[model samples]
Target: MGVFLAIPVSTESFGQKSFTIDFEEGNSFTVDFETSFSEGGECCGPYTIVERFNIDNYSYELIEPSFLPIFSTVYISNPD
Candidate 1:
């Protein structure tokens, strides 16, 4: 069985934003987020773990924004 987690992001900083989902199990995912001008453009992701693994408490930060996944096939398009 896989575990799912919810990761929250602050959309107030940017009108339309996305986030890279990382796991301690050597896996990762990405989700594209959008919102109307009235809605404020905030989004959250429901992350799931495919394989069972003991994930220790970890921390992460959003270093930069890119159209590519850095080193992966995951791509998100943000249309303002």
Candidate 2:
């Protein structure tokens, strides 16, 4: 018979904003992931803004559970 080990992996996103990872077994480590956001102008112009970030992975057991909000807003002047 062969022995097999099952590693538990869990993922959860707080408020649909950020992702949280939990590793049941193995050495503790962190990983960085890429995220992007886009904003549209509300004025008469088609102005937009884009932003990107490399967010680092965080352990759930190390910190308190909280919600992280990720959003972008664009403001433009209306010229008539």
The model with the greatest TM-score is: 1
- Give the deviation of candidate 2 from the true structure as CA RMSD: 19.5
Q: What would the per-residue lDDT of candidate 2 be over residues 11-32, giving only the tens digit for each residue? A: 3311112333344554233322
Best by lDDT: 1
lDDT of 1 by residue, 1-80 (tens): 33444555453443444556675665565554443223222473422211111122332232223321122232333333
Q: Relative to the true structure, how large is the alpha-carbon lDDT of every model?
A: 0.36, 0.28
Q: Which stretches of candidate 2 lie over 4 Å from their true place?
A: 1-16, 26-50, 57-80
User: For candidate 1, what is the total of clashing residue pairs?
Assistant: 0
The Cα error of candidate 2 at residue 43, in Å, is 21
Q: What is model 1's C-alpha RMSD?
A: 15.6
